[model samples]
Target: MGFWIYMLAMDLLIPLIMTGFGWYFSGRAPRKINPVFGYRTAMSMKNQDTWEFAHRHSGRIWKICGLVLLPVTVVPMLFVIGGDEGTVGTVGGIVCGVQLAVLIGSIFPTERALRKNFDKEGNRRKDGQG
Candidate 1:
């Protein structure tokens, strides 16, 4: 039980971090563009506009995914409360894997949006120009 609880806590880390950062980024992403931090990508780094757009776009996705994953993560653990260590560990691992998939997967939509809104030169497209 103790180990199960510990695993639960550890498994919760990703969702919590995602949610927290999502909330922060959605509202107040870093003000400046730099190579060191924030959502860095070729398209997103094209300019300040792309940088801000990527953050807000990705942040919104992360916030929603994190909120949905919270219950998804917790419900499975409820079933394994008294299970063996191996069972608990396996379930926990699967949940964390999903979280990681979601975290990495968010990049797609953000990149797509960037491509749609901005050209290779980072210039915002006019309506229907995409």
Candidate 2:
């Protein structure tokens, strides 16, 4: 019981934290170069324009992913709370894995958006300049 509760709390808390981070950072990400904050991919860091675009895009992705994950993480808890320890653990592990997958999955769309909006030289594209 205690273990299940702990797992449930952790599953809920992590995604909530991710949502908060995404919301806060998306709105407040710095324009200047910094080592510790914002999205720092090679394409994203190509310039100030790319950096800002990447963070803004990725921020939205993170927020959406976290939002989607919050309820998903809870579903397993409701179903497995009264089950045996092994079932609880398995469900908890699977939920956590899904959350991790969501986190990783966000990168793809963000990078794709960045590429769609900007060129390799980090210049914003006009209408159909791909």
Candidate 3:
């Protein structure tokens, strides 16, 4: 039971949050590619090959992780929560928090670095015109 909430958070809610995040970031008012602004690294690739390649690669990884984590973690949690027969507020809360921390901290920084490197250009000085 304790582990189940963590599973649900990591496998389900986090991904859903990420999806909403993508929408919010992509659907900006000006609709510009501001990687640093949202940590969303929307690479404006005119080349179809490069675009398709990136989609195939990074998209595939995200998909696979979702596929694996969903059933292995989330579904069981749904069952556990539905069952609801024990003290699920204490240990579960702590574990769930740790799971969230690990997931967010691990992926956010790593992806931030990746986007900064592969998608976004380096920061130009304010005194520009070079």
Candidate 4:
């Protein structure tokens, strides 16, 4: 039971973090662009406009993915509640892996959106122009 609880807490950590960071990034990303934090990418760092756009786009993705993963993670753990430590750990690890994948996978769509909305120079596109 104790180990299960511990593993459950560990597994849930990623989703919680993703959600929290998502909220922060969505509402208030750093005003200035720097290498230190808040979704740094070649395209995103092009300018203030790109920086804010990437944060807002990725933030929304993280928020939704985290919310969805929360329930998906919990359900599997609930099934393993009374299981052995190995079983609990394995399940927890799997859940964490999925959450991690979702977290990383979020970057793609944001980059795509950035490309779709803004040019390589970070200038916003006009109408259908790429």
Candidate 5:
């Protein structure tokens, strides 16, 4: 139980911080651009050429953090569930729950947050990129 909490603290905190950083450093604040469009705009190929100004690296960084956290998240969960159910379950559940919050809430939000404030470029918005 105690061990699970400790592991959860380590694995979950990374993603939580990553997501927080993503929001903290939001590019331009897309008050006008729609959410979906914002994502597309940031990830498109047209946004090339040393343009680390917008949500490119930040988005990628947040995503990378999430990706890394995805695997790390399993370790604590296994420890929690594999241990004794009576006592360990309670602690494990709590810790896993914390990581779950970051996984569910922050994960997608961070992705969306990446494109929260940016506009499309050029006449053709579609660059065949998904």
Candidate 6:
């Protein structure tokens, strides 16, 4: 029971935090060099424009994915709280898997956006690229 509760809390809390971070940092991410925060991907860090664009794009993705995931985490909790350890573990694993999927899924769109908006040299595409 206690373990289930912890698992549920973690599933809910992690996505909530991610959502908050995405929302807050999307608009407020720094343009300068920083070790932490913001979307720090190879394509995104190509330049300031790419960096900012990726962060903003990823932020929206993360926010949406996190929001969608939050309610989902609760469903497993309801089942786990009443079910046996096996069920709890299965539910917890599923929740984690979903969360991982969401995180990984969010990156694809952001990377695609980066590729669309920027050229191979990381410069903004002005003509037909966008």
Each prediction's RMSD to truth: 1.1, 1.6, 9.1, 1.1, 10.5, 1.7
Tens-place lDDT digits, model 3, residues 23-115? 443333223333343333334242332233333334434444434444544444554574453534443454456446644554444344344
Residues 20-113, model 6: lDDT tens digits: 9789767766767455767777888888888888878888887888888888899768865867878888888888888988888788888888
- Worst 10-residue lDDT window for candidate 5 reads 121-130
Q: What is the lDDT of candidate 1?
A: 0.90
Which residue runs of candidate 3 sit more than 4 Å off their true CA positions?
A: 1-11, 19-31, 35-61, 78-86, 90-95, 105-130
lDDT of 5 by residue, 8-88 (tens): 566566576666655543443333434453333343324432133334445555656565665666665765554664556
Instruction: Please estimate how well model 5 matches the true structure, expressed as its whole-model Cα lDDT.
Output: 0.50
TM-scores of all predicted structures: 0.95, 0.90, 0.36, 0.95, 0.35, 0.90
After TM-score superposition, what is the CA distance of residue 17 in candidate 6 from its true location, in Å?
2.2
Model 6 TM-score is 0.90
Q: Model 3 reaches what TM-score against the true structure?
A: 0.36
lDDT-best of 2 and 6: 2
Worst 10 residues of 3 by lDDT: 26-35
Compose the digit string of candidate 1's lDDT tens values, residues 1-130.
9989999999899889889889988986688988897989999888888889889998899899889889989999999999999999999999999999999999998888888899899999986256
**lDDT (C-alpha, whole model) for all candidates:** 0.90, 0.83, 0.43, 0.90, 0.50, 0.81
In the range 21-126, model 2's lDDT, one tens digit per residue, is 7897688667686787778888888888788778777777778878988889997689987889899989999999998888888889878887888888889988
| Candidate 4 TM-score to native | 0.95
Better of 2 and 4 by TM-score: 4
Better of 2 and 5 by lDDT: 2
